[model samples]
Target: MTRFRLRSGVVGVALLALAASSCASDKAGDGGAGTGADGVKHGPGVTDDTITLGLITDLTGPYAPIGKSLSQAAQLYYDEINLGGGICGRQVETLVRDMSYDAQKTAVAYTELEPKVAALPQFLGSTTIASVRDRLEASGPLTLALAWAPSVLGAKPIQMTGTTYAIDVINGVDHLVKDRGLKKGDKIGHVYLEGDYGDDSVAGSKYAADKLGLSVVEQKVKPTDADMSSQVSALKQAGVKAIILSIAPKQTASFVGVAATAGLKVPVLGSNSAFAPQLLATDAGPAFLGDFAVLQAASPLSADLPIMKTIIAGYSDKFPKDGLDNGVMAGYTSAMVVGDALKKACENKDLSRDGIIAAHRSQNAWDGGFGSTMDFTDPAQPPTRKTYLLKPDPKAAGGLTVQKDNFTSDLAAAYPVTAG
Candidate 1:
């Protein structure tokens, strides 16, 4: 397995202190250290009574439904925190904005809210974050990344909250070869997005294909690409035995439309981002019934695990009529992880960016009530990631049937890490 290296704890702690000191002027006051001794909060967006977190997302673009679902899920966690008296004697406040998934808009939005929020828990999309990454490091709030791209992960002070797309695909293709009955020399088709997320998945798929002696026929689509006929048509001509799809919601539907029309009879594997339950309600629904599987970052509420039960109840309470989804679960788990870090930082009386980062980095094997756990501290620690394999099941929550739990792929370990 590939390993990541973080600075030593002593060094990391010192850096955190230094970073906090550097950004102290951005805060509202000067009493920001060593406890609630002075009963004043020193960080931007942090006060004795409130800690405001920011969210940048697309609520009107093609991914609008996803954005709304994510926001709702995050709100669920924040509501719980506030109801329970909040962190460090302050209520958690979240300010959300619709960037429409545009990079320029994200930059504009961040500038307007940067000084008012302590951190961002759900800033999304690779392009949007990349546009404002450097600014985030110098003065922006300590944020949790929703995008697991290497670039995003490398952007310090914006750490990843889940497994990266590359690692997730590395493990996913293993399921295809080992468990899904594929052999060496079998043709594999990769239909992916034209971005860091899709490219990483393709890289992982290629890595596994090479290891297993499988051949791959690849196709790419833009984020806004509504039709995938040309891409799917190429895969059909390639005579692929199985497909690895890393496209978005609309693209997934377009692929399904093409696949179903072509009479293709192969199982399609996908990254976590590929599965949008809304597709199941569309005409493409039948195409997903038995032929599709998605690798997920965390198990859904259907596992009936105690933590999942809480998630289901919490989600129902807030949006009683709406169904849960991967987007929602992603938002929930990410917020939970960030919330844990914030609470921990509060314990140390430094609710600044460095405090949050240090608090997150100090722990190992932490689960944050999500059933699955991973270490965020040591640099050399191999990503001990587990990808849940889920197939489409109308009866299941989010229309996905959990096929495997805590499944780690040997191929995932073999794939190289390019972001260290």
Candidate 2:
């Protein structure tokens, strides 16, 4: 695990004080906190009576499908919580700002919304979350939840709900090799986006490959660049038995299609973010048909799981017109965790920021609709290190179905040697 060093005590105190003062107006209740006549509290972006949480997402960028769905899921959870009279007699409000997948724009949005709300519970994009990490840490421990893998490990003041970026890829690859009964020396290929996200996946794949006694033939691509024939050609030349991908939805589908076009027959395994059902429903999806595998940090969306059912039903009921995808599930899970913290915070007192963080850090386990348990007691690290592995449903054609419930066990077994 990577260790993030905290600032000196003096600097840390100054940041904490700044953060406290930012919320001082809310404490003063002078147009700062509490609900107003319209039932909204006005702060940085909050009005009277409501505690506003700001979300920065890519609503109109390459990652819009993910951002939009995630936003809807959080809204659905908020609506359900509010209907039940809210957390500690206060309604939860969400304000979303489109970041367009740009880091700079995301930083601007975060800067704009920081002083207006009681708390910024969750923000969706990885780039956006990373962009605001230092500011968040300096601004007094604002809680941020993100969808990208790198942000969880790289950013401060953000807690991830599942395995870290590198771990997700390592877990996914290990499952593919073990469950599929691949032998030692089997050639594996990786197709990934070429930045931190891709680097993390590549690093994880290398670690898994070393453990499984396999070899890797790697290919890299930009998330926005669609052409993948050249990279697929290289993987095919390597004669890989299985391929792992760490990419967004569009690129995942495109890579699968290109690989298939090059007459490659290897199974294509993917990280969690690549499990979007909508992408699988497309024409290019058949390339991934029975050959695709994914790692999910949460429970599968089966009717047998009450929590999954509730999330799906509640989200569908609340946002009837919006499409629900994996990112939405992630956002819903994030909100559920935040809600749990709020409930814990409000059990004996009002929903204050300190109380919420304390509740979060004190949790032994969380049942936030996800099958994997979340534990945050380790003060030195963020919560959540478990993961679930799934294979594409051969019967359903492109749909992913759970293969193993606690795939993180495999990762844990390999950890002593793999951790950097």
Candidate 3:
């Protein structure tokens, strides 16, 4: 196996300077005001003093830790922005609701927040977001989804910050073949959740397998399924050289632990949501550190980038006791996207729903000082095809270290994102 080290440069300073320029530009005038007196066309959830956004997430479910971290980081970002002078001369206020990871609850939360917010900054859960997307398309507040399945990209109003689940898996498989000695005709097992998240991951694995002359052995499980003893047994019996996991952190802990016990010591690659920092405190931590690597579109909180310093400083000041994780970066990045769009809308003097959507689409090359630059112009495709491969490390920030920075596999770059 080849070791890859983290590299840092002056990119963070450039991104900050650009952000400062954008903030300075906002001083020209409060652009998103109502047409009554300011001659500006304002949208819903916008007042002269405030701009409201929504966050519907899982605060009391299986993904509670990630949800909480994501929401906290968003709040931290907005707080910093508000203190620095606010966007469009208005303070950003977030309306938060916990859906407990249930689709029905998510629908209810969306119904409640749809009328009051200008846009949604963080809507978590793959299935939950899909349930309320029909309502979003008919109405209009542009929404940023925490989930990243390609299937959910059909709605114009909904957008994702990073690449899709399938893209990450494709890159991961490619990495295994190129760096980890995986060869053609070797069997790679995938244990995935049975919804959009897992299905999309499987799609990428299959695509890579076909191109690389490898075979994928799949095992599908529901969100609630945690014990991976059976799955590991099956994969071991199948003689898989590597394994892909597209489930949550709990399943990740279970799978790695079970695999360790079953002597199925193969290279394990996971999706973005697969591993959480909290997992490092468990008995499975060693297994995760040794054999598992996760692919994600965002940089971890411990990254050496200058933007991360800002994010981490703000988060530490606000939530001193909160454990650090990639969720903080994910949440802050999502807020950056929303803030950028709002700034653009304000500049256009049209803060309406349609105006916000138009402003967001204009960001063809958005660099948030994390991961890769994204292109938001095309709704049919993912924002970017690049992903980072990270490994669990107790000494690292967010309990993970970058093994490969902003990587785009040839197979991943060529794979077309198709909506389900």
Candidate 4:
């Protein structure tokens, strides 16, 4: 198992530098104008006619495939919005930065972006978000829209547009247990990366096991673990009824492939982060078959959904070369949420940080183009706690098939506290 250790002071310095540049650009007479409380004109990226939104992604990091797709989707949305006369007579512009999936780089990128943009639409990855949590909280009034699950818990000025890390895993487990009618004391095996991401799932699985009367057996792996035979062999010997995976695409696919070769046929369930269509298609192939399930926070990109159709058309028209993925949908939805908040802020012609924050919190039943609905009336709470389950499509080869649509039945009543 590969453990990532980040240098704190270096990340801080990078963030400080980025923030200074972003704010510095907001100096006198750039373009549009709004006066601050001190009677200073609104900075460069902002104008009376436009709002600049910032985005940070791991464009060249381990998660580059997902990051590139997300950035393309966000840019496409901006293009479409602008073409349609923009929001409330003002166009939306996105400033994107590549964080290279490094915590330090992500911190520096956010620092550069936070002061210039009206809001941060999407900050990708759990580790990246954690690195900047302190700075975000201390930055005062600057909020970020996040795509990572852990960011939902105890993260303020940052709203997650999906279920919390622990909650989503629990939801997946609950579905399997209820559907399969697994008895109390049924054995469940978990394979996960040995970091914050993996730890979150382990915690969630334990909670669900206690609530639903199942017994959990865990196997921890490093992010760089390419061989999962040992773990799969252990689980097979344990006679586990089911398996839950909490790792990235490469590792998850490896485990699935190895388990299949070892003749272990138990149903496998995974967190939302595990659903990478391209990776699954290329790495695991038909080996995954019908034995895997994934959680989705956004609506599926199936051509049948109206919102998805629109998004695909927009993306294809604007970003012809970049293929769509779940992260693309996540990025688009994040921007849409920010757009909603901006619309509300414009309604009152008050663009203060406090005003935008209030507007976001008051939002309820927001349709975010994913199966789940969002309600963020409490800033200190998780925004969306609903998730949809997806199964690997045996017939379609590489694609995912939706097993349940809008599985939000438990979200409203199950989770009581905001994640932190």
TM-scores for the candidates: 0.87, 0.82, 0.90, 0.86
Screening candidate 1 with a backbone cut-off below 3 angstroms (N, C-alpha, C), the clashing residue pairs are 4-379, 4-380, 5-379, 5-380, 6-379
Candidate 4: regions farther than 4 A off: 1-45, 140-144, 394-398, 408-412, 415-418
Which digits, one per residue and each the tens of the lDDT, describe model 1 over residues 273-313? 88677677778778888588887777766776777778778
**Tens-place lDDT digits, model 3, residues 1-420:** 000111123323422232232221222222343552344467777766677888888766656667777888888888889999988888787777778789888888888777777888888867888787778878858889888887668777888889999999999999999999999889999999887888899999999999999999999999888698999999999999999999878889999998888889899998988888778888887888777888998777777899988987888888886768867888898999999999999899888889899999999999977757999988888899999988888887778888889789999999988864
Error of 2 at 328 (Å): 2.1
Native-to-model Cα distance after best TM-score fit, residue 398 in candidate 3, in Å:
0.7
Q: How many backbone clashes are present in model 2?
A: 17
CA deviation > 4 Å runs, candidate 3: 1-33
Worst 10 residues of 3 by lDDT: 1-10
- Candidate 2: global Cα-lDDT? 0.64
lDDT of 2 by residue, 1-420 (tens): 001112346434533332333322432322243434643223333334555666666666566656666666777788888899977666777656677778888878777666655565667655566676777766533465665454444333466666666777777677766677778989898887776677777887888888879988888777677777887888887788888888777777777888777788877778877656776557676776657777766665552467777876777676675545566667777777777776775673534445456677778787764667777665334355566777665343124567677656566445532211
Q: Best-fitting candidate, measured by TM-score? A: 3
| Candidate structures ordered by lDDT, highest first | 3, 1, 4, 2
Candidates in order: C-alpha RMSD to true structure: 9.5, 9.5, 8.3, 6.0
When 3 and 4 are scored with lDDT, the better candidate is: 3
Tell me how candidate 1 scores on lDDT. 0.73
What TM-score should be assigned to candidate 1?
A: 0.87
lDDT of 4: 0.68
Model 1 ranges off by over 4 Å: 1-41, 378-384
Candidate 1 Cα deviation (angstroms), residue 33: 7.6
